[model samples]
Target: MCILFVALEAHPEYPLIICANRDEFHHRPTEAAHFWPKQNRLLAGKDLEAGGTWLGVNQNGLIAGLTNIRDPELIQSDMKSRGELVLKALINDGIDESWLARYSPFYNPFNLLYGDEKALYCFDSRAKRLNQLTAGFHSISNGALDDIWPKMSRGTQAIQAHITNNSNPCIDSLLAIMKDGTQAPDADLPQTGVSLEWERHLSSIYIQHQEYGTRSTSIILKDKRGKVQFSEVRYDGKGRNLGRNDFSF
Candidate 1:
């Protein structure tokens, strides 16, 4: 989604593990996480209008998510349609790090992740860039290529520090994203030099639409052992978790 941190080829046992918080406005009609009865696949939710999903992982080790390139004036009623990104990614066959660069499909300025348990590659469509992170430490946020995309360089680095110090259990990095820091991401912005508050908060990492928003979170774990596990959940108003679903590919 918008604010996503990826652990690519870092763990000795998994190829990639992703932890992200998909942010959006409070109003959007969405379905809960469930196994698609017709497709027999696990997904966060389906856009009834388009038969697409917000985020999903199939048994083929394919993982995909979406986020909008934030521009307030972009009030276009229909944005290339992110829902299509989620659904098309999983079922498609011609997707890889190299193929992504040439993929001219339509979607909000977003990112895509797909790999097994050995190596990982990420493509940020907004910048038209592709990166393969070092096996030991890796991450990604919204902005073009900045440390403050997450608005928490310290938090991200703090987790990296823990991962290096211990280095045994990579779970520490995943925990950092899930936990809230004592001081919000703002206090450390100055240390990051030009990390602006409004920019980070309203950063195009998250997006909203008239009837729908990506108010969900997803995590995909692929250990070095070639085992892939993932979790996708969607939430609604009142902070009610509509449901949670998990699957391994």
Candidate 2:
């Protein structure tokens, strides 16, 4: 996923709330979020081209999401796809410090978040570091954890408001916030080695570019009773809504 705003144990009824937008090249092949045909324990969208997933959650309440670090110089086409990291975490018991240290060097630079029902962990391949997240709200985009990008900040605030004000959070409101396409002011944009035009285009939470932009938006909510709801809205190359998928566990 490209942008993620998560609230962990921030509500009495809901223990996990996630609002994320997955950005990808419009032409890349993908399938909507669902239980894998054979591996039914895992629920996630499939990157058909790479045979891996950008995010996923298993029946045991283990969740994982990934975002590529924005460093064009470090990216290598021949390296392994970062989506494998999500699959690895979903099937494995857990990724510890030593596990991260041993395997991270082989993959392209990335930021990965994975954990079980009680705790969460973050690993950045570029930094070769791992951290456990405490309870509360947090955001991550194509940068370091909690990077002050306009979209990430606004998304966090939106999620926090939903959790604090309403006992039963409205999924539509969260989806609307994730659909926000507002660009930050010129002076506020971060210089991530991209042209001003490209930077402005990518600043919005919901990007709309012809070749590369947000391909789908997903909202996942998990209650304390072990009920999980996942909803995803797919978009086409021109930003047209293709379809939506909703699954529960």
Candidate 3:
């Protein structure tokens, strides 16, 4: 997942709301969101290449998502696939900070967001720090949790405004916010070790490119009654919709 917006206890009807966009190469093989046949309790899309998921939720209300840290210099070709972190988090009884701390070094830099509705935490592999999120709105991207990158700030404000205006927000409204393609001003772009052209291409909330861009958007809502609604929409490199999947449990 490239970017994720989280709202905890900020909505009257839903206690937890998550909207995330998975940005990757168009050629990567992926499976749409579904209840894994092997692990029926898990709901998520699979990265066929890595044999893992980017975001997922289990039968017991546990949620986990991951984002790569934008530090190209620290990436090692032999490092473990970060996608497995999400699966590990979902299948395990609960998050073990010590386990993460011990194994994080084996993988590339990343930020792991995992927990239940009652509480959520972010583990920063680069910094090796674990933080428990407070009740409010937050955004995470290729940097640390709640880093004020231009896209992160823009998306965060847009979702907060939508929630504040609509008493009961719908999946379409949240998906619209994630579809924003407006790029940030050149002066507002953060220097993340990429070319200026590449930076500009990735500045928008919804990236559009012939090679690397947003591949899917996932929205998850958990109500006060403990019921969950999960939705995922897939897209091509040209930003054309491929298909959508919805599940409730």
Steric clashes per prediction: 9, 0, 0
RMSD of each: 5.2, 1.1, 0.8
Candidate 1 residue lDDT tens string, 126-185: 678775545654445544433454443544565455444554544434543444323344
Clashing pairs in 3: none
TM-score for all predictions? 0.69, 0.97, 0.98
* Error in Å for residue 152 of model 3: 0.8
Full-model lDDT for every candidate: 0.54, 0.87, 0.93
User: Residue 32 lDDT in model 1?
Assistant: 56
Model 2 C-alpha lDDT versus the unseen true structure: 0.87
| Model 1 misplaced regions, further than 4 Å | 41-44, 73-75, 94-106, 117-119, 145-147, 150-155, 158-176, 179-214, 233-243
TM-score-based ranking = 3, 2, 1
Q: Over the stretch 23-109, how does candidate 3's per-residue lDDT look in tens digits?
A: 999999999999999888899999999999999999998899999998888989999999999999988835789998999999999
Best by lDDT: 3
Error of 1 at 84 (Å): 1.1
- Displacement of residue 48 (Cα, Å) in model 3 is 0.4
Candidate achieving higher TM-score, 1 or 2: 2
